[model samples]
Target: MENKQRLIGIVLAILGASFWGLGGTVSDYLFRHQNVDINWYVTARLLVSGLILLFIFKLLNPKLTIFSIFHNIQSTIQLFIFSIFGMLLVQYSYMASINYGNAAVATLLQYIAPVYIIIWFVLRKKANFKLFDLIAMLLTISGTFLLLTNGSTHNLVVPSSSVIWGIISGLSLAFYTIYASRLLVKFPAILVVGWAMIISGLLMNFKAPIWQFSITQLNFANVSYLTFGIIFGTAMAFFFFIKSLNYLSAKETTLFGTIEPVMAIVASAFWLKVSFLPYQSLGILLIIILILTLSLKKEQER
Candidate 1:
């Protein structure tokens, strides 16, 4: 039974990674190949996904109460912020950065999240200040740097604005991880995620004048993108992620998550012709090593 559960956990983790991988590559497709604007794509993500999940909840568990979901207003707000700032902003800003700079640089920069999380923990005094953590942090940063520099230049040449914004994206992710863990301890994870999506969708509607809501302009192509984003990218991936959380240790879960960027690299390489510079490849390798080492150490300590 233990082995069976572990196998299920492994499958869930892979499914989660696969869905995330699909989401990342699909973002490029919607933007470049399909001519779908990022704004529209985000808006569609919120609306379509939220509604679909709501219907699923209604059908599967009719006793579920919307009022019950609202009982933890603070957690709900944090979850919504997770969707808006953590997920939505990251997605939008990432696309913007790539457009402003290039995908290679943008991706390398956005991945600076692990470092930000360390900083976040340090500032909050939640994590022990240890030499290994510091070394791991340095390794993560160096990896990101190597990825960007492609092992070519001693001096990094990233724009200050892109760097700053990328850090903000990482900050948001750090907050999401910390806060989501806190909230999940007290509430149903699905309610937290679903309401968060609804709020995020509403927030996106007001963020810009992107979703025109024109039935006339809607086409099969755009709908196709929308369907893919909501179903495959948002709902299914999130479901598997939550399910995996139920069966795996957090350390095991995150180790498997390394699969996401790997999938990103593979898809980008195959479809987008995005290749790594030697430095960039070295950096990615280092980051993976750091995560593996630190995570394993933590798990053993526990």
Candidate 2:
């Protein structure tokens, strides 16, 4: 049974990662071809995805009240922070970065969150300030430099604004990881994430209501992109990833997640026909490996 479970877990992790990876490509497609509004898509994605996950939570754990997380004032506040600061920031910054630049570039920068996580641990005194952490940090810095410059200061590979938004996305991803840890301990992962999605969606909707937006053409191509962006990219990918956690450890899940940027880059090169700098790809690869090593060490210590 254990072996069977592990096998299932491995498959789930791969599928989850693959779906997530493909999601970036789909978003890139929409941005390039469909002229979909990034804010509107993010809002709709969050609303639909959150409601679906909430429904799933209700079905699986019928006894627990769905709104029970709000019973406590502290939990409610934390949930608000998670939704606005964490979810909203990460989703908006990431997509906006992609809009300004490309999905591959945005994703590679977001992977820098592990470096921020290491810094948090050291500052919090949760982990010893190891020499390896410094090395990992250096690798991340060097990787970013190489990716952006290819060792040349004269030319900027990505737009300055895109880099800023990508960094913000990375920082926001780190924030979500830390902020959500508390709520996740008290509630189901699906429920916590679901609520965050709903809250963020609602907050975004306040500024740009869904009803205000309309499709000018309403063609099949645009419709497919919108559906895939919400249904596959945002919702299903997250659901599969959370489900994999039931059988696998967080470290394993994250390690598998490295596939996302790869998928994004390859799809961008294929669909968008943008060639990757060999040095940039190499630098990103190094950063990914070091981040994995950092996570591995932490998991081992646990």
Best by lDDT: 2
lDDT of 2 by residue, 138-192 (tens): 8998888888777777987888888999999999999998888889889888899
Q: Please give the TM-score that candidate 2 achieves against the real structure.
A: 0.94
lDDT of 1 by residue, 149-243 (tens): 55656665555555565566666666666667766777666666667767776777786544475676468876775666668877877778767
Model 1 clash pairs are 143-283, 146-279, 147-280, 150-279, 150-280, 151-279
Give Cα-based local distance difference scores for all models: 0.67, 0.83
Off by over 4 Å in 1: 57-60, 72-87, 98-111, 152-164, 208-225, 299-302
